[model samples]
Target chain A: MSTDLPEWLLARQEPFQHGDGIAGGKSIRRGFVEKSVDSMSLVFRESFFAERLASRPGLLQGIDPRVKVLTTILLIIVAGLARHPTTLLALNLWILWVAKVSRVPLPMYLKRVWLAAPLFTGIIVFPSIFNVVYPGDPLLILINFSRHFRLGPWTVPETLAVTYQGVWGALVLILRVGASVSLAVLLALTTRWQVLLKALNMVFVPQVFIVMLEMSCRYIYLFLQTTSEMFVARRSRTVSRTSTQEQRCFVSGSIGALWNKAYILSGEIHAAMVSRGYTGTPKTLVSFQISRLDWLWSLFVLAVSLFFLGGDRIVAW
Target chain B: MHIPDGYLSPQTCAVMGAVMLPVWAAAAKKVNNVQKTKYAPLMAIGAAFTFVIMMFNIPVPDGTTAHAVGGGLLAIVLGPWAACISITIALAVQALLFGDGGILAFGANTFNMALLLPFSAYYTYRLIAGNSEAASSRRWLGGLAGGYIGVNLAALAAAVEFGLQPVLFHAADGAALYCPYPLSMAVPAMALAHLSIAGPVEGVITALAIRYLQERNAGILSVEASSSPLEGHSYKKLMRGLGMLILLSPLGLLAKGTAWGEWAAGEIEAKMGFIPGGMSSLAERWQAPLPDYGLPGFEHNLLQSSTVYIVSAIIGLGIIFAITYIFSLVQKKTTPDKT
Candidate 1:
C-alpha cells in the first residue's frame, strides 16, 4: 500500500522549510495552482486597495451612497448613449477630474480602466478600420490587391486600406467604452461595497436582491480565501511537479468540496443568524440620510449628463 | 458572455432588459416559494460558489488554462430558478466590484448568462436524463451535453446581438457605430471560439463536478429537477398581461415600419433596395386576415384602423390560447389515470 502511493505521499522533502516548523518549498515552475493562488491574491489586493481608497474623504465620499450610485449610473448610461467622440472624450475627462479629487491614484486608475475590458474591446474592433470591412474613403492603403476578385463570399477590393468613416466610427466606440468604464471604475473605487449594494435601491432593485448582493460580495472573499488556502496546503506538501491529470483531479475535487461546504454553510449561516435574532431584512447601524449637499451634487451630475446627451445627439453625423 | 457597456445600443439593451424582467420575476417567485425566508443565504452562497468557480484554471489542450463560467453546473445542482438568481448576483458583483462588465449592460449580461444559459442547460439535462437513476451515465452525459449546448447558445446569442448593431444602427455614411461585424462574421467567429474551446471545457467541468456529487452526495442529485416550479400557477396573470397589451395595440400604429421579418414585399424593397426573387414570388401566396393591423374596409379610416388594431390583438391572443388549450387537452388525454 505504501509503495503504491505516489512520490508526494512517500516522505517530506530535504531542507524544505516553511514557517512555524512546517516543511515548504516554492515550486520552480508556475503551474495552474500557483497561477490561481497568485490571481486570488491579486483579487484580495485589489479589494483591499479599493477599501483603502473608499476610506479616504474624497469628493464622491462626501456624497451619500444613494446619490453617488444614481449619478454614476446616469453618467454610465450617458456614455453608452453618446454617439460623438467629443462627448465621450469630455465625459472621460470629467470622470478623471473627479477621480483626481477623490484621492484615487490617476495612473493606476487609468491603467485599470483602459487595460482590462476596454483594451479587449479595442482589439476586437481593430479590424473594422479596413476598407473591406467598412467600405468608405480610403485613409491608409495597406495592401494593393492584384485585381478585384471574390474571396469566397466577399469581393476583394483593389487595395486594403483603412477608411475615414471606419476610423471615425471605431474612435467613437472606443471613446464611449472608455468613458463608461471610467465612470464605473471611479464609482467602485470610491464607494464601500456594502453601502453600494444598499444604494442599488435607488435604481429600483428589489430589497431582497440587494441583500443577496451584499451577502454574496461579503462571501466572495471567504470562498476565495478558503480555496487559496487549499492551494497553499498543496504547495506545501509538493516536492516535484504534479502531472496535468493530477492537477485537474485536484481542481475538480476542490470545486466539489467547495460546493459541499457552501451548501452546508448556507444552512448553518441561516441557523446562526436566526439564533442571533436575525430577520429576513438586513440591518445596518448607519442609516442612509440624504443632505442638501448630496442633493445639489447629484443635481449637478444629472445636469451634466443631460448636456452630454444633447451634445451627442446634435454632433453625431 | 459578459457584454461590456457601450457595445449594445441603448434600445437593444432596453429590449434585453424587458425580455429578462418576466424571467427574473418568475425565478424570484419560484425560489421564494421553495426556500421561503431561507433563500437569501442559500442564494448568496450559491452566487459566491460561481464567483469562485470562475477563478479556477482548467488545463486546456494548448497547455494553457481557462475558466468555466459555471452557469451549467449551478443549474444542474441548484435547479434553474435558483441558478438564475445565483448567477445574477454573481454578475452584479463582477460589474460593481471588479469593473468586469458594463454597468448599463448588466441586464443584457444577466439575460444571456443567468437566464438563457441556466434555463437551456437545465432543460437539456432534464430532457436527456428523464427518469434515469442518480448514478446513471446517461445523466452525466446529459450534463455534459447541457453544458456544451448552454455555452454555445449563449455565444450565439451574444453574436447575434453584436451582429444586429450594424444592421440596426450606423453613422449616416454607413459606418458601424457599435459592433462593426456583420452577422456573417460575428456569428461564425463567436461560434467557432465557443464551440471549439469554451464549450468542451464547460461541458467537461460540469460533467466532472456532477459525477463527483453523484458519488459523494447522491441525495442532492436526486432532489434536482424533481418537480416543476410553476406547475400549479394560475393563468390569470398571463391573461391580464395579454389584456393590457391588447388594449395598447393601437399605439403601435404610431411607428412607420413593420416589425423586422413581418414586412410586406413593398416595404422590403424600400428598405433593402430590392426584394428577393423568392420573396417576390411568395408575396401573394397568402394574405393576412388583418393587413397592417386593419380590417379590409377600414384601411383608410384612422378610427376604424385603431379599432381594428384592438380586434387584431384580441384575435392573436385568442389563437394562442386556443392552441395552448388544445395542447393541454391532448396531454391530459394521453396520460394514464390511476382511477
Candidate 2:
C-alpha cells in the first residue's frame, strides 16, 4: 500500500466530530465507557478506603458489624420520624461526633454526606418555597407573572414569592437526608464489605440473595475491567472521526456483548460449582460474635435516639 | 428514580413497604419453584449484571447522557419472578454497600422498580408475543412494549408517592413535610421525564438486545418458548399451515368424482364394485350437528355454498382451538403444582 494519502482525502473537511480523541473540541467529552469505568473505580476505591478505616482502632470499628448495621438503621429511622429541626440537628452533631471518634476525617465525612445531600434534596425542596406551592408568609418575592393566570391546570399566582415555612421545611428535609446519609456513610466507612454482607445475611436477608450479592460484588469488577479494555482499545484504534450514531450503535452492541458474556459466564460458573459438589443452596462457615461492647454500643445509640425523640415530642406539645 | 431517604414519610414508607411484602413473597415462591437452588449461581450473575448495567451512561441527542434501569430486559430474559429477585438483590447491594438508595426505602424501591417493572413487562410481553417464534418480530415488539410500559409504570408509581407526600403528612404548624410537590405537579413532571426519555431508551435497548440475542443465541430465549404447547411449530407456522390448507382447497374442484370412502351407499356400490356391510350400516347410524359441513338453506347457489364453506371452516377452526384449550386445562389439572 502507498504511504501517501490522496490530496482530495486530505483536503476534504468532514462534518467535524468532537470529544472522541480525534475530533477538535474545547474539552474531551467522557463517553459512556469512561463514565462507567469511573463509576466502577469509585466503588472499588470506596470499598478499599472503607476497609482501611474499618480496620483502624476506632470507636465504631471495635463494635460488631451486625450491631453497627442495626444501630445505623435505627438512627436513620429516627431521623426520618423526627418532626423538629432540633432533633435533626442533634442527629447531625452525633453523626459528626461518632465520625470524629471513629478516626474518620470530619471534613471528608462531612463532604461525602453533606455535599451530595444538599445538591440532591435542595433542588427537590427549593421549589416548595414558592407561594403557590405551600402558600405561607413570603420571605423573598421572586417573579410576578403579571395577573394570576392558569398555566394549564395549575394557577400561577400573580406574585410568586418564597415563604418562611417553605424555607424551614426545606431546611428540615436537607437535615433529614444529611443525618440519614451520615449514619449510612458512617456504617460503610467503619465496616468491611465482607463483614457487612455477613451482617446483612444474619439480619434475615434471604440466603439466595446473599449469595447473589456476594457473587455480583465479585463480578462487577470483572465486567468493569472488560469495559475499560473495550473503550481503551477503541480509543487506541480511532484514526478518523466516527459519527454519534455509530458510537450509539457501539454502545448498544457493547451492552448486548456484555450481557452475552454475563449469561454465558453464569452457566459456566454454575457448572464448575456443580462439579465441585455445589448445590443451589450455599452454606458459609463464617460466624459473628457480639461482645459486651457491641451490646453497649447498641444501647447507647438507642438511648440517644429515644431521648431526642421524646424531647422533640415534648417540645412540639 | 431511586427515592432516597427523607423523601417519603415514615407512615407512607411503611404502607408501601407493607404492600411489597406479599409481592416479594409471591415472587420468591415463584422463582424457587421455577428455578431450583441450582439456579443460584446464574441469579447471582444476573444480579451483578443488573447492578453494572444501570451504571452505563448512554449519550443521548442533546449532548447529554441517560442510564437505563435494565429491569425490563432482565424480565424478558429471566422471567418476571427471577428478574424481580435479581433486581431486589441488586437494589439491596446498592443500598447497603453504596448508599445509592435509602435502606428504609428499600421496600418502596423494590415495589416500584422490582415488582411493578418486571411483572408488568413480563405480562405485556407475554400478551404481545403469544406463542410466536423466538426470532419473530412480534417478540421484539413485545420486548419494546414491555420495557416502555415497565419504566413508565414504575415512574408513575414513584410520582404518585411523591405527589401523596403533602396530602398525607403535614406539621401542626401548617408546614408541608416530606415531598412538597402535590400529585398534580409530581405526576406531570415524572410523566414527561419517563415518557419522553426513559421510556424510549428502555424500549429501544430492550428491543435491540432481544433482536441481537435472536440473531446470536436463540437457544436462551427458551423460557417462554419451551412452555408453548403448539408442538414444535410456532403460532406463525400454524397460521401459515392453515392458510396453505385454505389455498389448496381449490384443488378439490379439480377432482372428477367423490372422495374415496366419502361416497354415498349407491355411489359406493357403483364405484367400489361392492359395499362392505359394516360401513354401509354404520354410516347412517352416526348423526351429526352441521352435517356435511353445510348450513341448511345456504347451499342453493355458488355464492351461498362458498359462504357456507367459509363459515364452516371458521367453525371448525374454533372447535380445534377449544379442544386444544380444554386439553391444556386437563393437562394443567393432572400435573402437580410445584408448590
Candidate 3:
C-alpha cells in the first residue's frame, strides 16, 4: 500500500503536516490510516478554524449557547463601534491574550488569521495610492510602458502615483480588518458549532437559518470525504493525465455528485431524526453554568473598553 | 465596506438612520403578512447560502478580493420584500457574529445593498425579459443580469454614502468631499470593477442554485415563482408607464435650462457688461465657502456644469422610476397568488 502511493501524497502525509511530529503520528496512525487522513488534516487546519482558536473566549461558552451568542453579538457591536487604531490594537491584543490563556495553539491561530492579510492589504493599497480626496505627497510613481505619447512640443507620459496619505490609510484599514477578523475568529473557536447555532436561535436569528446552517455544516464534511475518495480513485485509474481545465471540471463534477448525495442523505437523515424523536430544537445533555470567573472577565473587558473610550475623549479634547 | 462610528458625522448617520428605519419596518411588516409567510423558509435558506458563498472570495486584478452579495439572485428567486428581509438579516448576522460590517452603519448598509440593489435588479430584469411565460433560459438570463446590476448598484450606493459624509456632516476638512479623486471616481471605479467581475460570479452562482433547487425540489422555489408572476398585462403596462415617466421626468426640470441660462446672463450683463476681474472677484468671494464646487478656480472650469446636472438628474430619475415600477409590478402579481 505504501509503495503504491504517489511521492507527492506520501510527502504531504508526513507527521509534521499534523504539527505533532513523528511520535504523535505513530500513536494516531492506527485510526488515522482507516480514515481519509488527508481530509481530516485539511478540515482540522482550515484557515477559519485556526482563526477561531486565536480569538477570545468567555463565560458565554459556559452558559447556554443562546446567552453566549448574545454576548458575542454585543462584543462585536463594541468592536465595530471602535474607530481609532489604538482602540482596535488594544482590543486585538486583549483578545489575543484571552486566546493564549485559553490554550489555543499559536501556530494554528497565526496560520488562519494570516490568510486575510493579502486581501485586506489589497483593499487599502489602491485607495491610499490614488486618494483623490486626501491627496498627499507622492511616494512612488509607475509609468505605463505601453501607453506613451508626445504632446506637440513636450513629451507626455502615462503614470500612476502613490501617496503618503494612501500608505497611512492602508495601515489604518489593515488594523480595522485585523480587529474585526480576530473578534470573529475568537467567537468561532471558543464556542462549539452547536452552541453557536443555539445561541443564534436564542437571539432570534430565524430558526430556518439555524436549521440550514446546521444541516449544511453536517453534510459538508460528509460531502468532502466522499469527494476526496472519488478523486483519489479517479487519479489512480487515470495516471499521467493532467490538465488544469480537466482537473477543474473533475472537481466540479465531483461537487455535483456531492450535491446529489447530500440531497438523498437529507431525506435519510430526516427519517432517522424522526425515528429518534427529533423535533425542531436540538438537545444537548450538557447544561451550561457560568462561574464567578465569567463575571470577572466580562467586567475586565468592559473596563478596558471604557479606558479606550476615555482616552479617545482626552485626545479629541 | 463597513464604516465605523465617528467616521461619518453624527448628522449624516442620523439622516441615514431616519431613511432606513421606515423601510426596515415596512419590510418586517410585509414579511409578517400571511401571504408572504410561505417564502419564509426559502428566504432563510437563501440567506444561509449567501453567507456561505461570500466566504469564498475571488481575487481581482488589483489584488483585491471580491464576493457576490447574492441580493439580485435572492430577489429573482423570491420577491423583492422577501429578498430585502433575507439580505438584511444576513447582513445583520455578518456584522454581529462575524464583524464583517460595522454596527453603526448597519442601517445604511442594509438600505444600500439589500433594498436598493435588489429592487433595481428586479426591475431591470422585468424590463429586459418582458411580460411572457419566463422560460428556464430567460430565468437564468434574468438572474445573471439582475445579479450583475444589483452588485454594481450596491457598490455605487456605498461610494455615494461615503462621499456625502463630509458635505452632510460639515467635517473640518471638506477637501475629502471634493478632492481630485472625489466620490465620483471612487464610486464608479468600485462599481465598474464589481460590475465586470463579481456580477458574473453572482449570476452563475444564482443560476446554479436556482437550477439545483428547481430540479430537485421545485417546491423550494415555488414561493418565488408563485409570488413573482412573470406574465401579466397590468405589470407590463405599469412598467411601460414607468419607463415613460423616467424618460420624461428630466424634461420637467431641464426644460427651463435655456431660460435659466439666459436669465443668469441678463443679470450678469445688467450688473456690469464684462467687468474687468469680475470673475476673479466672484471666485475669491465663493472660494472659502465652496472650496470644491463653489471655489473660483480653474478646477471649476474643468468640470462641465450642464453635463453634471443633466447626468445626475437622469441617473437619479432612472433609478427611482425603475425601482418603483418593479416593486409595483411585483406587488400586483404577488397579491392574488399569495398562498
Q: Evaluated with TM-score, which candidate comes out highest?
A: 1
- Native RMSD of candidate 3 (Å): 17.4
DockQ of each: 0.23, 0.19, 0.04
Error of 2 at B55 (Å): 0.6
> How would you encode candidate 1's per-residue C-alpha lDDT over B108-128 as one tens digit per residue?
788789987998999899899
Judged by DockQ, which candidate is best? 1
Residue A6 local lDDT, model 2: 81
Off by over 4 Å in 2: A1-27, A142-152, B227-339
Pick out the ten consecutive residues of candidate 2 chain B with the lowest summed lDDT. Answer: B226-235
What is the C-alpha lDDT profile of model 3 across B1-339, one tens digit per residue?
454332333334445655656555555455545233233333444454445434433333443344556677667656776677777766765654444565556667787787888788787766665654444556556666777777777778677766654333221222221112346556777677676776666665555555555455555444455655434454456456646644653344233222234344346666667544765576567644423222234344435643453344345334433433443344334334221
DockQ-wise, the better of 1 and 3 is 1
Candidate 1: which docking quality band?
Answer: acceptable
What is the TM-score of candidate 3? 0.57
- Inter-residue clash pairs, candidate 1: none
Model 2, TM vs. native:
0.78
Give fnat, all candidates. Answer: 0.61, 0.54, 0.03
Q: Any runs in candidate 3 off by more than 4 Å, and if so which?
A: A1-10, A13-84, A114-133, A136-170, A200-291, B1-41, B51-70, B85-113, B134-137, B165-182, B204-223, B227-339
Mind giving the per-residue lDDT tens digits that candidate 1 earns over A56-174?
76567667898888888788778877877876776776677667766689889878887876688889998888888767899888998869999898898999999998888888888
